[model samples]
Target chain A: MTVQEKSWKEIPPAGICWKPSTEYLTGDWKTYKPIMDSEKCTRCTLCVIFCPDGAIHWNPGKEDIEFDYDFCKGCGICANECPTKAIEMKLE
Target chain B: MFSEWKFTAKDIAEKADLFMSGHRACAGCAAATVMRLVLKAVRGPIIATSATGCMEVVSSIYPYTSWATPWIHTAFENVAANASGIEAALKILKKKGRIKQQRIDVIAFAGDGGTYDIGIQALSGAVERGHDFLYVLYDNEAYMNTGIQRSGGTPHGASTTTSPAGTVIPGKVQYKKPIADIMVAHDMPYVATASPHYWRDLITKARKGIEVDGPAFLHTFAPCPRGWRSDPSKSIEISRIAVETCIFPLWEAINGEYQLSAPSKVIALRPERKKPVREYLKMQGRFRHLFTPKFEKIIDEIQQLTDKRWQRLLKKCGIV
Candidate 1:
């Protein structure tokens, strides 16, 4: 009813998608963040490789991994996949 | 927890998401998980053709869509053909100079029911015609959206709604369709079987599948917790057990050369480290009936079949 009530000029062009994929972020849905124990981290970058959300990155200067909490869903997959158990997920 | 793997979680986290979240997939759904992994393989523009299944329903309801990239929801039986059409149109556009950018990777996603049954003919035609595209089948082993009806890809001894385990029948007694092997016989450049638990291997295969010149088929093990009667969170864990027990192996045939992926490769290397089949069988409720004394022979049959299947795979890969 709301859509039909709109004026002719108010309606968007047909066959057009207004919202794109970038608008959908999952930061609010996460419950944890993976914290890497740098001392045990082998720099294998498995954490960077398996993070589905691209929430982790390599600190080029420090040569350690860093987490971008904005995109991290805290799936704990990084902690699970970490070979040395160097990464542990902390509750958000 | 033990294997020689190169990439880390850090590496995967650095890549941007092409398959966005907020989709309506089941919690811990393996299909949705694999979708994310496969999307990571393609960094550039992609056009995906999704069949009418869980992904289509969950991702593309009335007002919203979960796909970050452009996607089309095709019919239940003609997804491959639809994808092939898109591939052809793209090539034509490139030839006519109407499109002046990099080649767009066209991918078709389907469930096991769409792939191993209704869509097989269209799939065969597309692959046989030498279309350059990747067809990924997220095989959850049944028609989950329609209340778990038995499909052609359903494994032997698994009970579904249509093939219920009753006094007269044990379950769906037919073997799984050899999709990966059959695709390889099509002589496509790449054919792989992957699992969501093995993201590194799956990602690599997805990239290879897209890069190949002709049709590439990827059969991914999508664990349906609801259908399988397992804890939703156990999707990845149960899949890991499936591979460790050599029941759902991770393998790929690149240019006709078969190779076992991680965990499977590790397990196959050690002769004395074979995991017990019961460990995997006990996790899923569909296989629960097999544990009873009356069904011990069925259990034995399953185990024997698993061993024989692994042996056959090893022989094909030249490990034997």
Candidate 2:
């Protein structure tokens, strides 16, 4: 039997859903992407430490982490934690 | 067309109105307020499993009515267990297309007696099993439903039928159980402690907890006006004082990182903390024991412990 057939129930909805917004730290979904400044990159990993959700990432080859918007709560931990000022909490 | 409090008249009527009027809950029951706030966030067709306590007895008197949502009144120790069964069944039924989306969330409500003492093991088991549900403990610091006996959540010097103050024995020998700490130990996805005095905070925390992946626990300080023998209106004020005094800190733990949500500073910085504990204790009959010198020492110890915790929180939050 298929997963659905075997369980006789639908798959549960993924845990968190994001609501978009505007304003400086309002976390508007469409207006912004969590941008990282590669020039000041230290790859020190403090940004990842502060992220409420595990959305911030570090790429060893590119020498910087990326923010995954799908799961990010937009709590701005990364920007607050960036030691080199590489992560600025952009408007979104 | 008008608004009473924040809820529009239409909002009150049109919403589930789950905690209906004319129940036997004592005048100014804080747990009822908790239920009202909880209903605001969780739309039905939902199921609530309530353990036997003031809320259960008062709201669900056999035959006389109260709850608007589908609810199961279970033993004092089985609220979480029953809720888990409901949630598990709903999941299976939903996969088979037997239930609808609104029917997905099941909530378990318990009192301090149920949550901190009797029902703790069952709650821990269900949470560890990773059930998709929410457990709300309306803590009044004692078993108010059963003649105001001391439960695990009773404050240090609070007089209860069980731990009454006298010449030799002091009131409520043990400090309140750290329920949030216990839940955090389970590594649940979301855990929060909120008070009805903070409506927005309470609602936000409940919504977030429900939205999380696994079992989420919310421990709420629902002051018992009768059991506390305080003016009903002061329930909110007393709870607010508790938070300000760091006697009850409003915080949340998600995946083990603690976030200090209220005050954000040590009690010393908040002028309210300067208010004598007498302001809080004088309002409650439970603390009437403070009249004696022997019992007064417990009050001092409680204050010192609260100050220490507040200082630690401030230092950790870098607010000190």
TM-score of each model, in listed order: 0.83, 0.71
Per-model interface RMSD values are: 4.2, 19.7
- Predicted structure 1, TM vs. truth: 0.83
Which TM-score values does chain B get in all models?
0.96, 0.90
Per-residue lDDT of model 2, residues A1-92, tens digit only: 11222121442343211111111121232233457888887666544432322345555566556665654544343454455767665566
RMSD of 1: 4.9
Error of 2 at B50 (Å): 0.6
Q: Can you give the DockQ of every candidate in the order shown?
A: 0.22, 0.01
What is the Cα-based lDDT of residue B307 in candidate 2? 74
Runs in model 1 lying further than 4 Å from the true structure: A1-92, B1-8
Candidate that scores best on lDDT: 1
Q: Which lDDT values do the candidates have, in the order given?
A: 0.80, 0.69
lDDT of 1 by residue, B1-320 (tens): 11233555555655566666555565546787788789878847999999888877877654456777889888999999999999999999999999877779999999998999999999999999999999999999999998999998888888899988877667888888888888888887889999877777888888888888899999999888779988654677777888888889989888888998877899889967678888987888988788777676887888899999899999998897
True-vs-predicted CA distance for residue B71, candidate 1, Å: 1.0
- DockQ, candidate 2, comes to 0.01
Give lDDT: candidate 2, residue B167. Answer: 76
